[model samples]
Target: MTQARLRVYILSLFLIATGIAVSTFSAFSLAPLTFQVMGVYWLFSLLYYHLRINSRRGSTSVEYGINYNVSLILFTGPFGLYLFEAVYRLIGYLYKKKTKTDEPGEGVQTFYNVGSFVIQGTAAYYVYQWLIPWFEGNLVAFWVLLFLLVTVTAVVSDLFLLGVFSLLGDIRTRADVAAFLKERSILDMAKTAFSNGLLLLFLEQRNWTAIIGLFVLNYLVSQSYLVKAQSAQDKHERNKYEHMAYTDFLTGLHNRAYMELKMKELEKTKEAIGIVVADIDKFKSINDTYNHSVGDRVIQHFAAALKAKAGTDDILARSGGEEFTMFLRGRSFESCLALVEELRQQIESDAVEAEFQDQTSRIPYTASFGLYFFTEQEEVPIEKGYIYADQLLLESKQLGRNRITVSPGQQHESSLSTS
Candidate 1:
């Protein structure tokens, strides 16, 4: 399934599961309410994902944290946080959609930003203490004060180290987060800071349950983002490898494998295909006389030339050493020859002077082409087309080797067979 479909399905399952868990917890006591805060955060995250899909330019990974903050606030008293978020999005739809997309986050995400959690966590602690029928007033107030100090201090230290580490290039985006925050990497520094601070805060207030729950929640939260980042990194690496496999490293042109794939596609289409086979004329002579280094320069120069000459629909590839091929989309044989000839003349008249290996030299070079055209129903086999083009290349070689040779295929036979 597509990533989008999979994401939607997973989110749907999470929402259902969290809903059931919250309902069960609600039946026994208020313990599930804290997790419900997390659930609400997830719901907002889902909404943000949809919003991002609708606005490509404005999508940001940081939106997830923004949703978490809003969800925490909603649980405090204003019960319609989700509805409020929906209305806010509608009001600023155009504005938010115009924002630029960026990597997950930059620098510590701000002290004020994380400070909101302190406020919410303090409120949650007081509410929990007050809910007990036999709870005394002094105990409840002390617990509230204790939660404020520990949660605030722990989170502050995490953000402080996060800011410092970011300057040292230890920060990570969601797409590449695993490197810095492995099983016990630099990322743990932030977690360790938070844990120590929380220990002090809860110890002061003696709220053991809140301490345990907060620690567990923080672990879950960080790991969720880390896992997501690891998956994205894996995907990016796979795509990079696949691209390297099919691309010419030096010239950045499609390589032989891509050419084979194109041929397969053309076979399926049964459409007319134009092939221009190119060889760097006297390429080995240049390599011997001027050294292989300058010879590489000539190859790159001509590759750039071929790339520029190709039309928008053309596929230009480095088929082999000192050889190239261009498949021009829906073109007649004569025009393909004309283009190849134009490229020849362009290189013949062009002089490329460069300083290489501490020696300045003017390298003059030229190329030859053997053109072939085949409609889908041609009697000639695909491999034979290559042979025919090679023969024409020999003809170009005979005629001083710097021009285009139209194919020797019989037009009537081609028409009869393809028709």
Candidate 2:
């Protein structure tokens, strides 16, 4: 590991050790009422253990048990609080398989989860214990201030621990850290904190009816989170599958199906358009000499060159093996030749290679272009343009390859030397 990673691991170890020590110390010095409060806390913790609002992107989660945890820290010490939280998480680790299934290294993640919660639990304990005794007359104001202070401490502690753990993973910058927090929601934090404070208030008044109401309210929030997360995930999956259906998996370009859709859309427009069909010359020779892998690399290289030459509005697509097509909008027959010649020159000068047994050799290749241009006045079908381009492309291959053959009796021999 590098120095930074070493430091992160060291910090993790330190948090774990500190959490254990504080929990042990607090256990030895627990008040007589601590156990009674802890028993009730455990009941709520167990009930809310599975009620976590998992991130839509599946990065982190927010549990509805925050109010329960905060209340526990205020009544009992951090020792019993951390111990209960750890047990709850351990149960989750064993039975809960949703997030952990996709995530590797569950053992280390368990340590971080317990350690971070313990650290935050201890901080909340200190802040609440130190401040609550200071207020004299107005107990309502005192409770509000104490609740705000403890919640703020919890939020900051949570962010710090999460930021540290994120650094240990793939998150590398302040912007990433901020985005992480923003995506999770600061409003959720405030809402949970307020709920916990209300629970504490009701507990002081021995209002069992209000406590039950809070339970229902918190459960509803958790349900809403689950519904939102699942809906977002479903939408994301739908979009992903749609993209896959229309994309060329080999070269990461548009597939023929998508190109046909674009052609149909362009057919309705009255603007002039040019269709060019280009095929790699002697592609089978490379596949025969080397392997299919090397041929794939050559195709990917040519696709990148093609993308570079095409405009943002131009539609480029892979039309099966060794063949590609482009639809250029608002371009005449002459403009089509200029674009093809520049792209052909780029392909000629492109140095693409594939490695075999630590040896690399350039996969030199060329392509022949056949283009057809149509004007707004012309009622020529798009299918005719494709047929003519393919026919002219075959003619170029027959009569000395690596040349441009345009419709309307226009043929231009490439100035660039053939590969």
Candidate 3:
């Protein structure tokens, strides 16, 4: 392991040892009621473990078992809470091992969680004990104190996690700290505190039925929220993957696959369309002269220029390296020719900046284009038009690069009807 990982393991061990020492040295006693509460808490913890709701940000999660844990702290004090955490966390570790669900460093994580929970829970219990005398008679004050206790517990846990993350080099700057804090939801904290407050109130009244009913309702609500959140997460992942699949990694333009799909969709429509195939003039020479990186920048620059002039209904794609295609819809042959000519002129004037060996240079370049425009009355197949466009692009290059070649030359335009 690296030195950083070794240090983290050492820290985890130190905290675990500290927790065990404190729990052992402090006063401890057990009663029938303690056993009953421990049994119920274990059942709830196991259930929640299987149904944990992951937060939208970071590695934090929401589980109703937290309310029960707070209740345990209130009823049985530090010693009891520590005992429960030690056994429960060990069982969790073993279960993960058996199911082969444990990730790397899971053992260390389990120990760290046990130590942190003991420290946070024990501190909260002591604070509650110390402060109860000041608000013993006032129910409102007591409820507020419980809320504050929950807040303190949360703060302590956050601090512990932050410290560990800093040591792990996951957080290194002010911005990192700010982002970490941003991921923590104030509303979720409020909900946890409110639930803990209710649990403490029900415990004070010795209302077992109310406590059971509250937990049941909380579980159902949490499950419903989990389902909705999971559905939304799945949809987001699907869309992200779909976008990646259809996009060119270098230019961020639609790939050939997307262009093919668009063509198939347009084949069913009667729209007047223009198919254009364009290629960077001497792109291979550019790469050989500078480097592939400069060539990539040139391609990106060209794609951006085309994207800038494209209409909302127009389709532009990077069909392959140094080559692109466009589908201009609802345009007459003359309009399509004008647009292609304008694009050719713009590309000829534009230069891409390149850096090499601590030197910057503006690399001037040009592209050749071939456009084939057809009205709906002509009933030309899009596939055939694309082939013709590609052939014309080659013709432009052979006739001397950096120009636009179009079908039905200007001289023959009057012979054919326009869209």
Candidate maximizing TM-score = 3
Predictions in order: lDDT: 0.56, 0.72, 0.77
Position 4, candidate 2: lDDT? 60
Predictions ranked by lDDT, top down? 3, 2, 1
Better of 1 and 2 by lDDT: 2
Ranking by TM-score: 3, 2, 1
Better of 2 and 3 by lDDT: 3
Q: How high is the lDDT of residue 253 in model 1?
A: 91
Candidate 3 lDDT tens digits, 1-419: 44467457546754764665475545554667667767767776777676665342234322223445666777777677777887888898899899998767777666677677777777777788899899898978877787777778778877876776666566778898888777667677777777777777777687878877777778788778878988998999999999999999898899999999988898889678888899999999999999998889999999999999889999999998999999998787788878877887787777898886689989999888888775687566888879988998897888788877777553222111111
Can you give the lDDT of residue 306 in candidate 2?
A: 87
- Considering TM-score, which of the candidate structures 1 and 3 is the better prediction for this target? 3
lDDT of 2 by residue, 238-324 (tens): 999999999999999999999988888887886777788999999999899888888999999989888988898899999879899
Worst 10 residues of 3 by lDDT: 410-419
The top-ranked prediction according to lDDT is 3
Task: Report the backbone clash tally of model 2.
Answer: 0
CA lDDT of 331 in candidate 3? 81
lDDT of 1 at 393: 69
Query: What are the runs in model 1 whose C-alpha is more than 4 Å off?
Result: 1-205, 379-383, 409-419
Q: Could you tell me the lDDT of residue 359 within candidate 3?
A: 91
Q: What digit string (tens of lDDT, one per residue) describes model 1 on residues 1-419? A: 33344334334433443343344343332355544544544444443443321211112222222123321332332222323333344434433345643223321222222332333333443444464344335655544444443444345434533443443444656543444224223343344434544544553465657755664576466567667877897999999998999999878999989887876666666666677788888889888887877877788898999999899888888989989888877777666656776787888889667666698989887777777787677776555665677677677777777776766552311110000
Worst 10 residues of 2 by lDDT: 55-64
